[model samples]
Target: MIPAAAWGYQISSYPGTGGIWLRRAAVPHTGVVMPDDTDPANGPTSGSASSEAQRRTELGAFLRLRRERTTPEDAGISRGTRRRTPGLRREEVAQLSGVGVAWYTWLEQGRRINPSVQVLDAIARTLRLDRTERDHLYRLADIPGVPLDVSATQPQPPEHQTILDALIPLPATIVTARYDVLAFNDAYAALDPGLALLPAADRNVLWHLFTAEEHLQPLVEWEREVSFMVAQLRAESGRRLGDPHWTGFIRQFSETNGRFAEIWARHEVASSVTRRKSFWTVDGDEISVIATGFAMASTPDTKMWIYTPDDARSQRLLGLLVGRYQELGPAELLRRGARTGGAGRSSAH
Candidate 1:
């Protein structure tokens, strides 16, 4: 007899009016041994099989939790007064994710079924999973080659922010593996005043370069810089294949930017290296600087990029710009500098 606690069910008897009593109990087969030819070392042990089963159960529960928290209105479905569920129903999830109701039901029931990455992506999007939650979903689905750290968008440390601030005269920024601007010094912000004023979501270097015309206009050799940046991103993509944030950014960027899509299709790849970049300032002055990157100690995946003026003239211009920023503040300086054509520069090596 199976233990009631182990099976999670109880046996009970019902008494009949005719003086007969009936007892019923359901016992599920909980064990299945592997074939004799199975390799002992490589094959799943009974313990391993049980663990996998538990993981499936947990995965189902997690899906249910996320689904229950997602309201119909959040999924763009019209809410009805007679709705009974707290959030989205199973059918609603299936419909929104473009999957069949029965298949999704089996998945939610913890039945063993292989889910493709594409299907999982659709489900994740429908659930509106954040980076961490998306990573958890991929792992629970048994996807291979998962990123070592999926929570790549976590806030930058305070010390890192302070370090950025310390690099006041020289333009500096701390960026994630995906080139998201985690922190930037005032000098860096002054270099591109428009970028500094953008929303946090649009602050990423790659996103700004590809999507914003103003970002590209200041670069001396726009095509060359864009190509190299794309190549660098392509190289990083190999290590970040299954990362939701990385993948989502690439997809959205490609869809929105025709040039990015064209460049990405070439499949070019390059490693990051110190280089000289030049920028044409609003004042029609050409400033050259050397740009270099250093890995942050607190976050290995993040790097600090500093742009130092290469020539005496460029250095003096940068110092002048910094002084103006200190005196007038970021917004006021940007306004006055633009009006006066006072500052604009680039890095060269």
Candidate 2:
């Protein structure tokens, strides 16, 4: 919630985020790396990883912001006559939280140190953080619970598929923390090749952005959307620290997609959010969609994305796209694709 989990809350052609993340984006990787997860999901890595560094930086900023907002009187501390600091002092926060002053100072400086859960709890108490703030703190600290609701990551519950289909004209999909498309409706497939039309292996938001040959053509705000997407990935990495899935995913693209590799090196982090985006249809139609993200309390490993048109014109355009897909249907489209020997490639083919 604090790292802007609803996401610095944004916009694009689509808003089917789980908040608006992948579906509506026009193109390019956001170049954000999940932070401070060098611990590796199974084992720990050096504290020097870029993502970890970025997480630490965010943690420090969050702490400082909270600290600044809290006053001495608010913390039940006596305001001495000669007070100069606007809020409680660093030592005061450290002392109240039962942590070392130097350590807290380093934490604020964004140093490469791990803050335990207990310590974070104490700090949270000292800062009087609310539930959302507390969650954001834990995430930035790279604590294990940051991923939230770690359950079965695959073959999403049947009900979820039903929900996506029900969304109708809206494009929607379910995505993993790492941006893998778990499930999507026909509307989502209508958006692009990777949303649902592509083979399961290529059904990843990051993968499509990085490897799709014609990605640049569809994306209008390549830099902004790409940066936000990467930031989301970076924030999520904090939770999957040692998971091989994340490790392999990053490594594979780093080697296969040069631009992705370059952007991944940036190690950016962002909170999950909802927003609008615009994309160029294969027929050269420009459609703006609102992307919204919803959390699945039933499972933390997955999220739902729903995309709505941003205006009447886009709505009509979406209906047209949906009508085309409905007329042929995914199966018919697939069959046609196979006949043309372009089944797994982009529909634009």
Candidate 3:
């Protein structure tokens, strides 16, 4: 289903023929017919037939434009000197997408055939469509649902970084809908110093929880935490069905982590909410905390998570850790933590 935010409500209903949805408000008839109304040279007949014909014409034009803009290399095809066209040929697209050349040609011509979502997905992949382009393709092909906003992946502004830094003793980090760890404060780094050192590709919270045993060792209820995180990812996936990055991430992560694959296959989904958590410190002492997540006002697709101590003992322990980290700094703390062979190696987002 399309998210209410991504699509305008002006569309009335699907034509059920893989054609564009009909608008709720009709265009005025404006009965003044042009002199060329019946002239085959001008185009198809006018009125409702003309509207449907025009939509097909526009669909064909849209497909052509996207096709022309795409390059052979972009679709993983080797460039050849014989090719006169700017982009992929219809047969080349059909071959790459695993469809019949004639059918693909008809689709580009806006024929009456209705394409299944699976077929449209194949075509979208072949064209190297991004999230927005894929959504536009779906709409042109009369597929339902809204695309996830891509702006979520844009670099966060400096103010966001400042906000994270200001969180201070409390561990705080900003994450995208895909759970990419975009930014983190010193307190958060203190919580898991090794995380800040990890390569950007390995910074995803779920990826760490599932694949990195060292990071998982500190969590009190490992299975429960992992299951909840998987459910949250599943929920996000529903809203971004055909997105290449989202789909590719899932495929790669699943291939690396069998446990995540099993849980993901269950198709469970859950909304985000505050939860109490416990992590073991280097001294083997439990640090109970509450983790709260909130959507950012400036970027709805981004979220901020803050961890606060849940009890007096936990609070003192957190304060002590933060104070020591401030005094020693990240490098010294990491060096000491490494030599001690303690929970300092454990990391989180």
Candidate 4:
């Protein structure tokens, strides 16, 4: 329901009839739209505020334009010649982007549409947009193109890398607050073979735990572990509503993991980080380990992860993973908490 106050109502509902007659009204589009000047009370009048509305209006137009620019051949549809339109048909775009034809129509008609980054990205991909074009599309839609906390979304800073190396024999790794595996010692890679095979972006621990069903499930203590992971991702996601990367990740996972989708939909957020977590290895060895996450002094996204064993058996397990460790230089230590690395590393795991 539109806000009653926006419609100049002292109290909601009609005084006598109790019918929601003048709750807030939306005037039809008129000539010329500007930004931030329209009477928001009148419900989207044709003035400057309409400019924002126009920008939204252009989202539909731009989507349609993008649709019209591509050919049937570009989208792998058959062309019998004697064509009229310059681009693919509305149906073609709907089919290609995995959206409903009616829904796409409503979108192109500019009906208060706010698409998730993943949906917009799918449309962008269907239109064969490059990075710059994709970025521009996001700007026009008034949504973030990438994660807002880019610093928090990245791998380790240089100083953190040194810390990871120093924790070498202990099988230490560096990850972002969101569970991105930024860097790891040789020992960590040896202990977790899957870590070595993943692309840098897929090194995100949360992505693996959430999306890679086969890889993590066997090792996970489902009742508590899964719940904890879900809670952690839930909290991180809340902190990044406008972040493009997080938006895309959530959409993808929501489709793939129904349980995760359900939990995320509840709007639960948990920042609880305990000092310890226990796990059983594939070899039937139960390891009691300490899990610590330190906030980056400079870069909020990056942190050093050190796994210290609580017992001799776990310490022996660490020895089997890597050799002796060494401390990093002073310069490497200085870059520890700052956002380092580049853009290519920011994609969803």
Q: Candidate 2's C-alpha lDDT?
A: 0.69
Cα lDDT tens digits for candidate 1, 224-260:
9889989998988877566665688789988988888
Give the TM-score of each candidate: 0.58, 0.52, 0.58, 0.48
Worst 10 residues of 1 by lDDT: 22-31
**Residue 265 lDDT in candidate 1:** 95
Task: Give lDDT tens digits, candidate 3, residues 4-123.
Answer: 544322212322225443222221221111122233577657686576566656777877788888899998888887888889887788788777655566566655445656677778
Kindly list the per-residue Cα lDDT of model 2 for residues 58-172, writing each as its tens digit: 9999999899889999999998999887888888998898876555766786756666666777898899997678878988987675423222345677898888888988988
**lDDT minimum window of 10 residues, candidate 3:** 26-35
Total backbone collisions, model 1 = 6
Ranking by TM-score: 3, 1, 2, 4
Q: Which residue pairs collide in model 3, if any?
A: none
Q: Residues 173-277, candidate 4, lDDT per residue (tens digit)?
A: 766656767678765654454545567756766555555434222233444566677777777766557676677767887888777777777775577564565
Model 2, runs deviating above 4 Å: 1-153, 215-218, 329-349
State the RMSD for candidate 4. 14.7
What's the C-alpha lDDT at position 195 in model 1? 66
- CA shift of 216, model 2, Å: 9.1
